[model samples]
Target: MARVLYLGGLGRSGTTLVERLLGELPSVCALGEVVHLWQRDILDDERCGCGARFSACTFWKRVGEQAFNGWGNVDVLRVHALRDLVERTRHIPRLAAGHMPMDEVREYAGFYAKVYNAAAEVSGADVVVDSSKHSALAHVLRWASDVDLRVVHVVRDARGVAYSWTKTVTRPETDGAEEMTRYSPGRSALLWNAHNAAFGLLGRRGVAVRRVRYEEFLTDPRAALIRLADFAGLTLVPDDLNFLRPDHADLGVGHSAAGNPMRFTVGRLPLRRDDAWVAKLPPRQRRMVSAMCGPMLRAYGYPVFTEEA
Candidate 1:
């Protein structure tokens, strides 16, 4: 069967890095944020910051090779179909809860093997990475019977994520601006909280999940990649990542999400904990994020200095 990995975590938390690095395996193909179900109405919504449309990207092309009956487009239909197949194979009790069993995991693995073989038949890839960082999706993948699944949890400091918004209205990489969450100014903190809350449950279970701190991954990329590759059961050679040009194309460059992935350059570097919030946030906003998420920060080993003091 085809091997699959779940590279998911809090949004804006660095799951992309995991996807890119894992792509090092000849059998591995990583497709970030399959949010088609959430945005079911807009299949041609836009290309990700990676500079490829969800409809015709090289990444999805590889995944399509593994899908049931050569799924033509990576749309709501494909996602729904995949979700249903997983549910049936695994005997998922709650669609919302997303719980599964060992038997289901095996079934899912077998189904994915079919996908991988199909992908190999078409695109010659052996593994697939799905960056649908939602905890519900992650839960299903971890326990489903049809596949062998690995879940990578990525987390960034809440402060760093909050400050990121202040740096620019547009995302650093993806310039597309229509979806910016302006309803709540403090939405980043809420996003950080909700995203983590979902995965925090898995951490408590003490199996099928591993957390990757964004700062740590950035600080020692090669070592981090090696560790990650090892966790996913792949042999890592120095040459595997050289061909990865993070800035190969700019998605969401001109509009609002410009500073996203397109803004991120893939390179060998050390982990960093940026304090952009220190200078960017107003006192009230900073206080609110601190007051609201102080516990989560400490739980992840991040210091909540203001709260302690």
Candidate 2:
């Protein structure tokens, strides 16, 4: 059985960083957001973390051959269409309610099973880190008997996430091509609450879940990794904290289809909280975001107060 550590949460919640850190372990194979594989990496030929085009990566090429007989055999458009229907957040509640048609669920699970199984076979790692950031997909995988699924639900402060989304998006993999992710403060807040709420619902339904707050992890990475390592069923190096020392994370070749451009980042990684939004975001926008996120913010231990007193 493939042990899949699925990262579930909204974007800009530090899932990429957490996935990269765990991917450094010998027993773990980090595949960035396989959800985007069909369109971003395979169809668009995006750069993999190994600095090669997706189709040019030897490991992924092997996975393609192993998973679907060959990369050419996979129909990108068809798979994407099915995925958009099955993995959309709007479909999550129904999927959980067992209202999703069995055929759709089967199709979704069968395709992903091949992907995850192929990844484990090609990488020779029992555990695969998939930072897909989709609560709906995570719920779908819970029913896949072929996979032993564990979830790491990452939550960041809504204000921090809202600010991150507003910043210019850049992908190191694409050089200067602008990443098109931008959301207004109000939209970001509403999505953050909904995303977090979905994951919470999953946990209540008795999924094997571990909640990791971005702020808490940054403050004490060693402790966070220890808990995560246990949940994902991996042993850590005695001095795992050394991974974060010198303000950089050592990275390896990862063939993630969709993720932050930082996936192309190698060598030492600086660790710091981006709280610039507190000082730079307009007071009115901050107040609006706080109001939108209101009770949910407090539920996650974020203060409802976004403006400086």
Candidate 3:
């Protein structure tokens, strides 16, 4: 079986950073967001973490060959259609309840299994990290018996997540000036609650799941990395974590298929909590986000009422 560490969470919850750090492990291959592989990589030919276009990246080229003969052999449209059919927030209930159409779920998850298995084979890694961060896809993977799936549920303060969606970040993976999709504070808050709740259901279903909060992870990344490594069934000696420091990490070039522009970052990257929302987010929006994410915010140890609010 192909060991997979599936990072599940809402966007801007710091999954990309977690994925990047884990990718540095000797036996792990981090594939940014395979859910976007068909559209963003295969069709758009976006930039990979290695700074090469997906079509030109030797690693992915080999992955394509290993997974399906070659990228040319993939039916991007068919995969996209399958994704649309089963991978959505609305389908999470059925997927979690195990009431899903097994045939469709298996078909969708088979593509992922192929990619993950191929990634592991091509990278010579024992485990593959997929920071797709979608609860739906993680649930759908349950039908893929070939994949040994482990879930890392990354969570951030709902307020911070809401604030992140309010900002305009450019997508550097494309040639043209394109911006990442933005969502309202309310929408982000609701999503934070829903996505986290959905992943929680995985734990109930007996899937191996670990929840890592962004705040705690950044505060003591060394310890966090060690725990994460152990969860993914890898060992990390002290020397293996030499790349990490108290305040930054020494990152190397990765070949993630899709994710935050930070996926393309290399060298020394600072590690700091993004608390801009505590002060910059309008007071009214902060209150609304807190109210909307009330139970989950508390569930994740975030204060429902803050001094800033």
Q: Candidate 2, overall lDDT?
A: 0.83
Which is better, 1 or 3, measured by lDDT? 3
TM-score per model over all chains: 0.69, 0.95, 0.98
Q: Which of the predicted structures, 1 or 2, would earn the higher TM-score when compared with the native?
A: 2
**Consecutive 10-residue window with the lowest summed lDDT within model 2:** 240-249
Candidate 3: residue 118 Cα off by (Å): 0.5
lDDT to native, each model: 0.56, 0.83, 0.93
Instruction: Estimate, for each residue in 225-270, the C-alpha lDDT of model 2 and write its tens digit.
Output: 8889889887777765466664556665566766887777777677
- What total of clashing residue pairs does each candidate reach? 42, 4, 0
- Model 3 whole-model lDDT (C-alpha atoms): 0.93
Candidates ranked, most accurate by TM-score first: 3, 2, 1
Alpha carbon lDDT of residue 211, candidate 1? 80
lDDT of 1 by residue, 1-309 (tens): 445667666556777555655554555655445433124213433554445444455544544554653344434554455556554412423432444444544454444345445544554555566666766666555554445566788888876677665553443323445444332337778878876876766556543567889888766666777777777778867676564434331122211011234223433422344555566666777777776788999999987765321
**Root-mean-square deviation per candidate:** 6.5, 1.7, 0.9
Residue-pair clash count for candidate 2: 4
Model 3 backbone overlap count: 0
